[model samples]
Target: MELCFGWFLLVASIPAIFAQDISHGSIVVDGTMTVAQTDDNFVCATIDWWPHDKCNYDQCPWHYTSVMNLNLSHPFLAKAIQAFNRLRIRVGGSLQDQVLYDVGNLKSPCHPFQKMKDGLFGFSKGCLHMERWDELNRFFKETGAMVTFGLNALHGRHKIKRSLWGGDWDSSNAQDFMKYTVSKGYQIDSWEFGNELSGNGIGAHVHADQYGKDLVNLRRIINELYKGSQSKPSLVAPGGFYDEEWFVKLLQTSGFGVIDVMSHHMYNLGAGVDPKLVSKILNPDHLNKAAYTFGNLTHIIRRHGPWTSAWVGESGGAYNSGGAHVSNTFVNSFWYLDQLGMASKYHTKVYCRQTLIGGNYGLLNATTFVPNPDYYSGLLWHRLMGKVVLNVESHASPFLRSYAHCSKGRTGVTLLVINLSNQTNFIMNAQNSINLKLAANEQNISRESFTHSLKKTFSWVGTKASDDALLREEYHLTPKDGYLRSRTMVLNGIPLELTSTGDIPSLNPVRVNVKSPITISPLSIAFIVFPNFEAPACG
Candidate 1:
């Protein structure tokens, strides 16, 4: 998809405040709040299920042997996996390679195959085979998730030479494990030959040309082995840091048709960088720039061959230590939504967030699977939004940014408005009949700040000691409501009132006789779904 950004404005009004009592506006959506989906209108997260210190490489290993081995018959894990109809699992990391060498009886002395300091088991000497092929097969069968295996491609003994590229580069043990995983009906969507080949800056340095050749050889082998399959797993190469030239050359030499998708990595914040600036990197504007970069790279690839999709295979809001402040807050939701909107606008597909539940950027707290603010946002998105984008137009309003999309069945439309200005008000005018459902709160409110038990007061409503105490207490009290109110506003000679209800106490979508300008408050997000509309329905 082409990624481009442009400013737009809408100015118009109509008559009639329309309302439909039949509840004809019900709409369904998949609102997963995943950056990958935002980047590409597709949502997927990475899964690494290894135990801590179970295999030493880098970072703490995940300790979940029992969890991983749970019976597929159980509904909890199975249901969770099903919710993720389309998921991607990266099977190898530094730790994974360590496990492979120490556990698998690969005969070769590949770089990754060599035993390291404090090795758990003698690699060349052999150790217990810990390959979890059966476990993985059962999991995928139960969850319906796809796998992307990262094979060891380091130099020295592990490097798969031009002639031996098709053959397993690692010892016999590793090859057997690879073949076994594939045989168990596990579908491999993509195979990244190695991890961050360009960024690591060390190991067997394979230039773009070399990498491209190796990729071709791997693809040939995979295709030959699975000849009857209707689709071949994409051969992804250069799994590295951004190198436009290297990527372009690889595409040119390999032929565009040979590759399925181009992959790269991006971390907004790195070591020594100020954490306070983390929000800026995660900001929608910056994410737009990243999308533009993706567009530009895709354009370069298109020059050599037909179009190929792109993916930010690995990325998070932060890198080194994550954002000191903003990574875990409600403000991050803005970043998450903006990223998804921009990515969808550009048509990029398949965004894979770096970590699902670890590190600072994780959706859940590293130790507790309890969701962070970002996770809640993700859950909402996955549960509420649809896959397709809709066309929307907004008038000039510095405080509010809006997006519109029709539901999958074209029965309803969802309009999303985000108010970024801290103190400004936004007035919105609808040119047609529509229904709105809004979710809003003060810009600074924390997830834990409000609970279901607390009663909320609106800025516009007045309170009385009792229903009949208006004259009894002689007290004039401010309204407990927090939303703006309008009465009989005229637009093109039609009347409308900005009203509120119990469901959305902070905001209201009033029926309008004419599409007149409606105001929005600072730092709020609103959604209006139009089930059916006709001109001048209210009048």
Candidate 2:
């Protein structure tokens, strides 16, 4: 009888046990002021040139996925790129400096990368044949992918010391490659010089002044190569870690208008082999650490190189090929999405992920060519997030992250809210800029009081014109399973997966009453679009 009574008690407590706690909060989206703006093709991914033998932490994750070996005929590959409309694809990596193009000039026979005892990253110089280059351009054309090819910045420069490289960059080979590209009628959006040749580069380092001089020469070559062309490519350089002194000199020496985009690489979460990788991704404090770099870069661009903007040329939360299990899983989306929103807020023009495919961090699976959770996140971001960033504040909790932007090609605002907490489902009320102005004029009411209200209505939109006007679209994203490490993503209540024919699944949202507070589930992200909401700035 005692056991029976215990069973009855357990059954009674199931609802409360499974339910999450509700925390009330306020989110004031000041749509009147635009905080920042990102590029139209803000969503970007990279296709690295790592060979199949590139191993890390006792694991070989990269397979036949370099520029020379990636299967261009793969249907998933083309569909994925086309999904972004015009996804900016950067082709470069650590080995980019050692790469030599086989386009023009009479030199030694071109060869593939071979294992070398003391070679940069343990591999000899790699070559890109003209045929392969033409194939890549044709693939880009078919997929409508914007290309930003990285030139061999270390070509013709002799190694001075351990990792220090000195001497002028030989532009002959690069010019020949550019001339061929122009002759083929390929459309390249930008030409990036070097990989990580700035501030004690990854495998090789170059002095700032020398790099600057070489950049000026590269600019001259570009002008000559594409003279009178309607669409002249922009120049981007110094794709490396952020070094205040090194970056300042590169800009000062190269001077303004020479470099169009100052690119940098970021691996804020440390190495991929760390055991504490997932824990760090969930920590708000750890994520906020990247703000210093982004904020500082914004200042540097506005002050030093006003002509050129900043781009997170390459960022994979945990570098060194990314965590084998963690990076490609759903948990990585927390870090990836947060960084994208944070970068956009800081006026970062473009943020290219470490890879489109190949590494463990690739948006698509290396073996199956399947879209991972982060892939869906990127697609939604591309389909939803507009260029204009809006000011959004959440006094709810430190764990809750909120970012608002004018809706992409729409008449309202889209609020991206990420709940890092595992137990608290936040209920927040969103107000437009009208509240800010109203509260500013009425001295009796405090700003805090202005944000907290039920059935908050905007004065401009006198009343609901139709039944749909009272609703907002909500896209709740969570792991397929309750586990944070799940590879699949669940949107609302349905699982996100590709069709049998390899087409990307359409992202659909459910409409919820706008008068009621938005209930964001714990450990989930909500992209709520207020289509009919009166956002004067958006208008």
Instruction: Give the candidate number with the greatest lDDT.
Output: 2
Query: For model 2, how does the per-residue alpha-carbon lDDT over 114-181 read when each residue is reduced to its tens digit?
Result: 88989999999999999999999999999999999999999999999999999999988888889999
Model 1, 400-436: lDDT tens digits are: 4555444333344455555555445455444321222
Model 1 misplacement above 4 A: 1-41, 49-80, 88-105, 108-131, 155-175, 199-205, 269-273, 278-287, 390-401, 404-406, 430-528, 533-539
Off by over 4 Å in 2: 1-19, 439-469
Model 2 clash pairs are none
Clashes of 2: 0
Tell me the lDDT of candidate 1: 0.45
Q: Where is the poorest 10-residue window by lDDT in model 1?
A: 470-479
As a TM-score, model 1 comes out at 0.62
Q: Which ten residues in a row have the lowest lDDT in candidate 2?
A: 453-462
For residue 516, give model 2's deviation from the true position in Å.
Answer: 1.7
TM-score of each: 0.62, 0.93
- Native-to-model Cα distance after best TM-score fit, residue 389 in candidate 2, in Å: 0.7
Clash count, one per candidate = 48, 0
